[model samples]
Target: MPRHFRALAVQPKWHAHDFTSAAAFKAWMRSQLEMARPHLTTNQPNLVVLTELNGLPLVLRGGRWATPLGTFQRVAAALFVGRLARTLPLMWREGVSPIRALQLADADANTRLYLHTCRDLAREYGVYLCCGSAPTPRYSLVGGQPRRAPGTLTNQTVILDPQGQLIGVADKVYLTPDEEAGGVDLTPGDLSELRVFPTPVGDLGVAISLDAFRPEVIGRLEEQGCTVLLQPDANGAPWTAKEGLPPDPANLRDQPVAWLESSWTASTRGRSIRYAVNPMVVGNLLDLTFDGQSAITGRAEDAPEPRSYALTSPRPGFLALTPWVTTGTPEHLRRAGRERAAGSGHPLENEYRTDVIWADLTLPATALTPPARTAHEEALSAILGGQASRNPSRVAPGLLAGLGILAYLSWRGLRKR
Candidate 1:
């Protein structure tokens, strides 16, 4: 009989209060895992995946003054004021701006909290956990303590075994423009360094966010005999808004339709990679907002055509998809966007909710067998041929606005000093 396993995709809402302290963050994470407990099976392996940059909010831990600030600007301002002595010198020494400097100053603490929380959760749940990504400089555990080293910052994902020990780490290779020089200023991981992690369920390949949209990245993983793909994402735009210009010439305005070209389109394209899980983070971080439906996709053996499956309908490829609570329609989503701009909107307008979408999937009889490139690949070639118009550059407006706010605040602080 073929081996079977359960895959859980977590769609978590980001809240500033959750990061009030290490204890609070861990408790929130535990609660999210608890939501998945009912779906797990004792007879098979379980793989739990969270969204990209899920741990990035931990930077606000210990910022009790900023907990009630809610909006990104106010909280950032509070953090900047509270940690001026540390951020100022680090900013000057590292030749970085105040925004990046604040992140760096708390990098070590963020890593410890993020890692320990996920590690403990994996052990408690007895599952293989992909703890999502965190933006931090490279570091190592020295005497069981996280020690930082001088290096470029990268969005890195960690995988922990059921025993609560880390088994894999994959840094994001392809970065969005916002993650480049002008935005968060993160360094991209080398594509050559991508690794396939072995687990009881199957061989796992992790493609963080935009990385999943690249054929080269997917091909490299398939070449290494990967059976399952984990694409943890945090979409920075309205899920119902038009996907921008040019490539979307037909005026294809739906975000979910445009998103299909990545994970759903990849796994069903006649590769050995049989299943994919995409967990998206929803909610806003200051002027920056992320919204998307989390989904699980798979290729069934008896399907008439090579099509991907999702949990929710209206789309064919997804086996399971988490629904948007408040921004389900275009009008409502646009209204929410407007409210965010005016700085007056109900928090639920961003679809801030925690959901878990999971499915029992069959694993390949042998984990090392290479997948054959079939006609399915040829038929679906167009999907991955050209890049979608919805690239990271679209976030420039929000980033610019946030930067302006930071600049004004910094100038005022300097003048007061």
Candidate 2:
């Protein structure tokens, strides 16, 4: 039987450097959970969501900036450099790697603060909490449990149950250019490492910001029976217009807000999968404008109402989704079947005039009949990919002839010597 419950996506405005004090950071963290608590009120277990790197902002806040930026130009310069070049020498003196610098000072303590705070929220609310992503060097969760690393680091997302037990972890598979500049070197987590976290709502999977852009990652999770793709994101300047470009659309490179949402919608299309809840970061970090388009999308033609819903603002609040389990409509089913029959569902929207998405969703059974690949198709792909093996009988004569020539050359050379 299909299970049902409430799922909340919180897209709060991140105040950079507001939590410079450890005490203040922890207090602010609890308040953020308090903002999300009311939305999760339910007898059934709920799944609470937050954006990627949500905790890292606090970590960064705790660390003092060596160079202060007073003007917009200075901020822009800081964003490009990511301030790592100036800080690397200082970090080395502390006996730590450049990669560890990204998580800032007192890395382990700050990380524990973030984790413990969220765990408390989960236990308090009795909700399954899929906490935000963060870059940490000293700590990691591997194989659904804590894996303490003295040096290694990854951009990881952690999920906890109502009782505050660890459910799963998803490390990012890709990193942005900005992260690389910030000395955030991460080992990408593979498909096998990305496990599905079973919750009261459904089977949950996570794809951190950059991972969400990789379609193959999502497809692999779907193949492994994921019902909802929890996308924790912290994006910078993808929505801003190109400053020096020509007025003509062709001459300039800039995408409209709708265009960005459309691209994200395409990611959830045709898979017959249920929902995609994306909670994104917002506010200015250095000069980086974290775009605040947190959205929740569903399978094509599945929900009768708006399957694609988004929140544009970063105000402290919650966007809740109550999942109503049922079979797809005939029209929706026809489109899905056509996609299955054609061996591909053509990738195929939402509330008007609002940044936040608050709505009910129509979903189906967690398990569905996915389009299976035929042997002939698989063989063709293998052949095209140069993976097909050559026949042993065809190569034996050539191998023997080559060996014979080699032996003859050695014999002649030895005789001449």
Candidate 3:
């Protein structure tokens, strides 16, 4: 079997109630897997990547806690500054405190279910898989259960092997301003410590969503002999809009920004970047819509432009990328990680469902295309995780705006209630 093989991106139409029961969740996943199973060829190591926090709905099955009460509270809090004054009494009489609702939902059972589901999928499909990302507690696997060390939960990515072995977990290092206030109440990962796991496909590294935006995180991973960047994302917004709160969740169409950014980013960051899987969270949960523009992106050294391909449906669909290794000996490929971007060539195959989109992205991986680093580049990369935006001067200003937004959201009204 050739070392290079096909990779499947699983995009599911996840509902708020799917996580209520493990059986239901697994059933949903199985259906999607069955759809993609037809494309999985034999004698090749198959890789499956999902979006970020795709399993979070399991914990959200908790009653009113899963309601838009969180969103209501957030916006109301933001506007009123500490006075749910009118809303509090209304909620009190209605009988469910948004605060209590938020507390009631826990990832304990959800986490276990998530692990079991991914393991089963890997074992069943006989393919390597990333259970996508989840907002799991700051945890360590002691024995078999995931245990936290008394810190805020971290947005996590669980990597699994074809044999169903647990490889490594990558955490979301950078949280958006909105994430800080509401969302998962996530605690960012230590930027200095990155997780790159050894996979059947060379050394595999994962950057959950925004982590790819910084040059530092992906830069260091590339520096560490890591290839096959598995990015499980949950960016809930239209493609064209660069930044800010997303619009209404009712729109049934998806934009192309997810793949667009990743494509250009791969060119700038030096690697074939892929997996901008829209954290497709669909349902009646706080005005958030994770549309299905899940994409597979990469760049070929010979090609003038980077490749960006994704689904257009807002429902369920996926992008298939057939990985191509350089026409060289095993030893050459092994050391390729240190010298150049892993899988520097083009994608041999790019296929998808929904609309049945297909493309040929094959390129020979021969030379090193790693960009030279400068003093300012080094310092900035260290600060930011990946290259999200090209404007270096805007970095400090972006940080300031984020800080200001965070401070505004931290107002008393938005706090917990």
Best candidate, TM-score-wise?
Answer: 1
**Candidates arranged by TM-score, highest first:** 1, 2, 3
Task: Put down candidate 2 lDDT per residue, 1-417, tens digits, no spaces.
Answer: 556666667665555455555556667656656766666645555677777887665544433352255333333223223434333443455544343443443444556666666776777778777888777543434553344454455677877787776666677776665554333445555565665655566677788876665667777776677777788877554333332121233454332233233324433462534676776655555444554456666643444343322212222112333221113543453343233221132441011011223334434445533234323223222222232122211101122444444434433332343
* Candidate with better TM-score, 1 vs 3: 1
On residues 199-270, what C-alpha lDDT tens digit does candidate 3 reach at each position?
554356677777766667777777665546777766554222334322323443324433444423543346
TM-score of each: 0.78, 0.63, 0.61
Each candidate structure's count of clashing pairs: 9, 3, 13
Regions of model 3 farther than 4 Å from truth = 62-105, 141-146, 240-259, 267-286, 301-412
What C-alpha lDDT do the candidate models reach, one value each?
A: 0.70, 0.52, 0.49
| Residue pairs in candidate 1 whose N, alpha carbon or C atoms collide under 3 angstroms | 72-286, 308-317, 309-318, 309-319, 310-318, 310-319, 310-320, 311-319, 311-320
**Superior by lDDT: candidate 2 or candidate 3:** 2
| Candidate 2: clashing pairs of residues | 311-355, 311-356, 312-355
Error at 359, model 2, angstroms: 4.4
RMSD of 3: 16.4
lDDT of 2 at 383: 25
Q: For model 1, how does the per-residue alpha-carbon lDDT over 114-143 read when each residue is reduced to its tens digit?
A: 776787789889999998888867654455
Model 3 scores what on Cα lDDT? Answer: 0.49
- Candidate 2's displacement at residue 391, Å, is 66
Error of 1 at 37 (Å): 0.7
* Candidate no. 1 TM-score: 0.78
